[model samples]
Target: MHSVQNTLYVMTPNAYAHLDNATVRIEVERETKLRVPLHHIGALVCFGNVLVSPALMHRLADEGKSLVLLDNSGRFKARLEGPVSGNILLRQAQHRAALDTEFALTAARAMVAGKLRNSRSVLQRGARESADPGEAETLTSAADALAASLRAVPGAADLDTLRGIEGEAARGYFAALNLVVKPQARQSFALDGRTRRPPRDRFNALISFLYSMLMNDCRSAAESVGLDPQLGFLHAVRPGRAALALDLQEEFRSVFADRLALTLINRGQINAKDFDEREGGAVMLNDQGRRQVVTAWQERKQEEITHPLSENKMPLGLLPFVQARIFARTLRGDMQGYLPYLAK
Candidate 1:
């Protein structure tokens, strides 16, 4: 099992990160603000105008840690890492599998099934906990619809058909998600379907930020296990896109990112005042909001869960790595097929 390590996020604008022997030091306005031992860090993620010294970048690469850059709104910009240490044979197998329609379809079906099943779990749990009879009925109806989608996964004739099923299921899921927010907080955090890029509403903005971090983890997981991040079974291949990472992200979106976003909103950890409305009607979390989310994200990762397959307790943060290894095994023919992480 891969142990969960810390990801140091540099969110302060104009903050400078440099190497100080075995430590990573952060300075602002020419004064040291924080220092963390390099060994404790698995990755360094910088949001917005954070600066990283060249020496620190080199060290990070040499140590096999990743450095990710994102805009203030958490849009991906770039990633830096060490030389490819992944097995060429594993990647070759991944490529060959991508070209095999049967293999690709099977993998895609598994991924979609995992996503729909996890999403249904979320809706059903919300339905059970909802105090309002009408809200509970709405959630239950959505959950039943997702169950129907899950049933259709095996019968999907092609990738396009499978994608259609997933897309429709997602629409209903998001529509029902609006009811999950506490009634008192609904005015502030109500989700208006699912919008991205600039995320028109507050809920969309919060989840988009969480999704960016999840994408980074998924990409890193694929790279660590010698899988090709660009070639994927479900998502279409495109230049500059980590298709495999996006593929892996599907199963975790509801169980990880969406659930956390709801928790923060319902528990009042995040509020309307935590976001900013830019001139163009774009909504985003302010610095203070980002800090609150980051702290919650870190804490959430530390919570332990037992794997449905391995039955071993592991940190939630390691799910991506575990699933990536499972994917590699399937590509290598060691496993019959890809088994997604089913959240219990």
Candidate 2:
């Protein structure tokens, strides 16, 4: 089992980070702000203008830790890491499996099935919890729609057909996701539909930020298990794109990122005041908002959950690594097929 470790996020503008002996120290205005042992961190993520020393970068890479940089809005900028590690034979098997159309289709189907099933679970929970009868009905209808989509997954003839089904289901799911927000906060956190690149609304901005962080974890999970993050069964291989990471993240999006976003919004932890409206109609979480979300995200990761397959409890943060290992097992023929994590 992969142990859950902290991902240090440095979002304070103009902060400088450097290696001091066996620890990483952060300084602002030439004064020490924080110092942490490097061994305790799995990854170091910097946002905006934070500077990292070359010695720290070298140490991180040597220790097999990742360094990720994102813009203030949580958009990915770059990632630095050590040389590729993991089983060469396992990666070769993964590459070959990607070329097998039947295998690819089967894996893609399972991924879509997991996504739809989890999405329906979210909607059904929302329906039961909603105070307003009309909102409850709307959520129930959407859950039913997602159920229908789940049924169609087995019938998908090819990857394109499966993708089409997933796309259609996602459209309906997002359309109904608005009801999940509390009634009083709905006016301020309205989400017409999913938007990205430059999230148009506050809700979109919040979720996009969470999704970026999730993506980084997924990518690291894939690499940790000796699977090529670039080669994927469900997503097409492309240069500079972590297709396999994206594939692994499908099962986690609604349950992890979406759920956390809703929790923060509905519970009044994050509100309209947390976001900043930029020129060109882009909305994003300001520094204070990012700190709040990051703290909540870290806390959420510490919560334990029972793995359906293993029947063992583990931290929620370790799910991606577990899933990635399962994927590697399927590629290596230890498992008949890839089994996705299903939320209860």
Error of 2 at 342 (Å): 0.6
RMSD of each: 2.2, 2.2
Query: lDDT tens digits, residues 190-225, model 1?
Result: 788999968999999999999998998999899989
Residue pairs that clash (backbone atoms under 3 angstroms), model 1: none
Q: Distance from true position, residue 198, model 2, in Å?
A: 0.9
Candidate 2: residue pairs that collide: none
Score residue 275 of candidate 2 by CA lDDT: 95
- Consecutive 10-residue window with the lowest summed lDDT within model 1: 1-10
Model 2 agreement with the true structure over 126-179: per-residue lDDT tens digits: 999999998999999999999999999999999999999999999999999999
Candidate 1 lDDT score relative to the true structure: 0.92
